[model samples]
Target: MKKPDLISELNTAINQNIIIEKNIKEIIDMSFKIFKKLFDEFGLELEKLCDFKYSSYYSKHKNIDLDLAIVKYFPKKDVKYKEFLEKILDTLKNLPYGYKIRKEQNDGYIAISQETSSKIINYRFIFLVRKKTKTGYCDYYNRNGIWQEDYALELTKSFSLANKISNGTLYKVKSLLNYVLKDQFKYNYGCDAILITWFYEFFSRSLNKYLDNKYNKKEKELDFVNFTKIKNLKKWFKYNIDINNLYYFIFTKIGETNTYYYPELSFEPLELFEGITRYSVNTNTFFKLPLSYFSHIKVFDLRNYQDVRLIQEMGGEEYGYSKKAWSKARDEDKRYFVSPFIISGPFNYAMFKKWYVLTSNSLFKTLPVEIKKDLNSLRQRESMEFLNMTGHNWISSYYAKLKYLQPYFDKKYPLIKERDLKVLIRMITTMVDKTKQSDWLLENDN
Candidate 1:
């Protein structure tokens, strides 16, 4: 039997403004229906355990392909929540239709995808628990915000402990502390320290009052320049910082399950550091540290003489920090640590709209020559035909074509409005229809 023409079907779907198998509302409703059924099957009260929030799509267009629905489940003491969740996941996984379950720890979501011919719909759920404390109920979900002060104090205490462990070597302790906290506090790694500091400063200045002035002062004075000289920073960080004490503190306080890596020290290198020093925890054996153990430290920039010296001492010359190397590592880190596994349907549609704009602009000779050339290369008919012929789904086929064109579109027209793209698509579609008619007339007359 001959296969259905996927491109023709896709084009027809686009022309009718029906690119997705189901719209956002329908998809979300379907998800809830399925969840309700699952809950009923397990003799569970869905409403009692679960709450949901619908996040707006990226595009404001009514027919936007993607929507996000966050489902939060609060565990009760009487309920076997973990087993129930596992059962749900197992049922979903064993379904005949295509379903992907991704548990992302960082984002705190269990994303389940239901894929159709045209799109992959996502339902993201977060399981939250509240513990009874002396003051009140502590919501574990928002602990990062509530517990920032506690974390800062803990970190400060850890630093002091490290100083004592290093035989009162304050400089070494300060250098290593800076190295660990720099990524969390100053750098952009979505850590809690920056947020806590920002909130304190912003509110203090806005209200014309200092809230926790001591913390503000301490954070301000904790700059890298104040702790150690640029040259000696590397020496102290490498040789003098008590690795044993560092490991113990991190393992006990952060690395263990309870603290959730303590948002402040939650960078990937810390995970690597923990793994490297895992055996040393609660053991008398001293394992010789491998040179490669510090390899993940390259993600940090060579800040001053200290950073440069540290990198050099770690054989930076041999493992050159070229742009390509840095980019590769950064990309890997994003994939492993940052980027969400779930694809945003609305974002994908937005990308398609951008491509349409670029194509229309190129055809009408409005785009730059370089962009036109790139666009033409990406839209080569033979390549697209080949991809469609290979049984690739519409999402895969669209992205395969887009993989090359997207960079150019992003670089050139980063802020192309949705309304403008829609207008252009309509105009381009009308123009193409006229062009086809004219060609048909000419061919008939000939």
Candidate 2:
């Protein structure tokens, strides 16, 4: 796993890429030169240790060609890793737009800003680099390419620079040797090893498959960027990778499902980023908040609010009254017969604009006095029925604060018993003062 040994393994892989007439020593010398030129241009620096594997290297599958890719796992606290990656990207001008360097944090795998479009083109970047054994091959491959079957590796190991330069796992002994040489050489050597592994496992498969199918095969060539293909690839990855799999244990401390309030159906705010991020790759904003907040309660509680039950609730209307006639108040006795619900029309743009104004104002003003008093005194608020008559309406807080006197009116006077408006107002002030005094006494208890 030292830089020289890694240079040796890469030399073996590069020999397969193009026709090389030079001897092995000369081939390695030029290979490093070619790599350094490409490496410096790309701004990639390898970690002190990493892992690499080659697929189809010894197989008779000529059509398989080279499947190669590199996965660079940065430390959770290493903020400088990001800037280093950006520098490499600046140097490597020829890397296709689809060429992405993803930063997989605890929250989720975020592709570096420049690499959004690169995902579809470079399918291997999203996957984990598992040590490929004979049986493990299927776990690494999906519709797009090989993905890491296990996310647990992040928790169990610390990857060193020497692990990166070798075609297999690295140990302490070889890593120390690499460190003694130009320590930067260890980083560069590891970079080459990852590049070789990536080319042999992931990249070669994609490039070779496309070439063979595009020019030689009789089958319909797939546009790799096709929505249907992309969707299928995404679905395939989701089905195979268990959500419990952890990537970077420190930064990605939580899985998306564990942190998710509802994991069965993904309604997370980041999903909105997926929807718009596809079309407008430059977008940093997500659309999840509006959709979650505005989601209809009926749709959310589908079983309880079925159409059959709704129809039963609404059937009290007399056959004599047209639906339109029910729109206006008729006899005061008819109030019990009328359905209070109103359905807004599709494309009700004007209504939406008006509702936005009303709803925005309501949130601040609509706290009920009892609820406010409870919150102020006890640091907890009272719950309402959530039947948004008062709940959804703006300025209802002011009305709720008015405090109903219907019970007092019924008790105080039997006939012509409208409560004096002035008396009700005075009661509210008196009650507020009394509640404040009560709250202070309660607070003193603890």
Highest TM-score against the true fold, candidate: 1
Off by over 4 Å in 2: 1-37, 40-43, 46-88, 94-446
In model 1, the worst 10-residue window by lDDT is 336-345
lDDT per residue, candidate 1, 1-446, as tens digits? 87443223323323343122246547657666776576566543332110112121222222222212222333445334455456656655643455567765333335667754445555554333334554233333322222110121122222233233233333222222222222111111111122222222222122111212432333332233433342443343434333333322322232111111111212222221111212123221221111110011122333345544533443222222223322433454321110000000111112122334343333235334553354357454433233222212222222222121222113234422322433433443344335421231212211
Q: TM-scores across all candidates?
A: 0.26, 0.16
- Tens-place lDDT per residue, model 2, 291-344, is 111011011111233533443443222211123222322222121111211111
Clashes of each: 0, 29
Model 2, residue 424: distance off in Å is 99
lDDT of 1 at 108: 34
All models: lDDT?
0.30, 0.26
Q: How many angstroms is residue 244 displaced in model 1 relative to the true structure, after the best TM-score fit?
A: 46
